[model samples]
Target: MRRRVLNGEICKRAACREHDMHWKTLERILTFTEPPGYRLSQPRGSKVDPFLPIIKEILESDKKVHRKQRHTAQRIFERLRDEHGYNCGLTIVADAVQRLRQQNKEVFLPLSHPAGEAQVDFGFADVLLNGELTKVALFVMTLPLSDAICIQGFPRECTESFQEGHVRAFEFFGGVPTRISYDNSKVAVGKIVGNREREVTKEFLRLKSHYLYEDHFCLVRRPNEKGHVERLLDFARRSFLVPIPRVESLEELNEELLRCCTKDLRRRLRGKSVPKQELLNEEQQRFLSIPEEQFEAKRLQTVHANSLSLIRFDRNSYSVPIFQSLQDTASASMRSR
Candidate 1:
């Protein structure tokens, strides 16, 4: 009886044997009422990804061409097939480029700037001064680590204008950054002989030396490297210039900009209690300082002294002294008569 019960075949008493059952038999008797929680699906067939190679080819060809000429997808595709043996349909190439561009991640590299590293760039804005539509170019500079910005307005964006703007910004900041980043403007870069080396202008080189700072040119067509100044320029145009649509003079415009950038805008967001001016102060402590005596940045040009003792610049006649050398370099002198 005990053996039968232990084996789960029958109970101790013969009368109870009807209730005993094998564990395997009981499992077989039970049925599941609920269906499976998940269903398995088969994967579909793979489509041909012909655009992969086309995309790679297009990117390679684009890297070799200059930016000014490589504006459209059709142009790039044509170049790839004619020059690089990339035999693909134009639509396919265009689609590939679109996909690659969407998938491409912006690669950011760590840029190190010493205490005095600065970057400069130009920005444009339109204003109505005295009910007259006026367009002006604003020059902007940034201390990378501190994020301190300096901005000035110029009548034009010529090399002379840039040179003067830099001098004014340095004077306002009271020091020069150790290293400055600049775009490949005609004012700074003279010519690009090969793909690698560039011949910069003489005056630009002089400015760099005078400030005791090294000048660096941003990569051709890559403006993101100098994003600091770009953002600052936007801030300045919107914050300072937009509010005051008209000003009596450039000096007045600059004065208002300084006040806004330093005083009002410097205040932290409401309830945050973090002052922008305090941040600039800390940045200044880490910034590079100018030498004992400030370098004099002069804009000298050779001009002919006319009978009226006037020198001409930008079609505007400026009066000079009669005794000055006629064909020699003279400091720009202005006389209102």
Candidate 2:
């Protein structure tokens, strides 16, 4: 309005009529270069101000209790009225709670995913395998820096399958990541000793020894530490396995998954200039070279045959062949217990 009036495009009366403002307001707008911001003469005080300290203490104490047992706005209002003799409306208490909670909200730093670092996780998807709708476990590995991903389907998520997934992922990536993050799955961690300490399984140790890559296990129930793979697991399921794939075998399904991963490498992500493949190529330069010898993706265990010629493994019983004699393998006088 001021620009039009001052620039002689329109008269002040016409400008006021066009802007639907009173002549005084129009004159004020013309007088000043810009509208001054509003100011309160005096800040308003709330009835709940006297009980704010007690409210803060209650909210602080609520943090130590179970989330389900925490105080709601109504409960806090009742406490303020009954316990502290606070005679304020529920709206005020609720508003105060919301404001305090917002002030006390947790803040997280942005994660920096350096090159040659990856995260591993598992997801599940339903697929038609051999004409049967089967739920398959998907082993997902993602290079966080590159946003490159590799996925393979397995019949079950066992230690053998877990090891095999790493083997195939390393082969697909053309090199092993220098550092890899994983959840505390039994396949890798035999036992968690303490914070950041793990008693890794023998097979897991063997795999790491062969690849020469450092292992990082996430904290108990803390999946966000390796959130890259966790999110990509869902991405793989939705983008690659959507509409429920139909394949004759797990091998066939894996081929399709590999193709999808390769094709996805051509896509340029939001904040990146180059395609994911270029980033992956750069990341591979920092990766550990593949070992000369291959790592076996299986577990070895020795079990004795029982009196009924049965051997027990993984909570299931398997019968020993009738033709094979335990006597020969066992000590001459020892019983086959």
Best by lDDT: 2
Candidate 2 lDDT over residue span 1-337, tens digit each: 6677889999988987887989978877887887876747699899999899988999999999999999999999998899988876899889999999999997767689999999999888999988999999999999999999999999988888999999999999999999999999988999989999999998899889889999999889888899889888888889999899989999999999999999999999998999999999999999999988888888888999988989988779999775445556665546556
Query: What is the per-residue lDDT of model 1 for residues 197-299, given as tens digits with 9 covering 90 to 100?
Result: 6798887777776666777788888888888788778877887776547876767777776676565436564454566556556656654566665545455
Kindly report which residue stretches of model 2 are placed more than 4 angstroms away from their true locations once superposed: 1-69, 322-337
Per-model RMSD to reference: 12.0, 8.8
TM-score of each: 0.60, 0.77
Which pairs clash in the backbone of model 2?
Answer: none
What is the alpha-carbon lDDT for the whole of candidate 1?
Answer: 0.69
Best by TM-score: 2
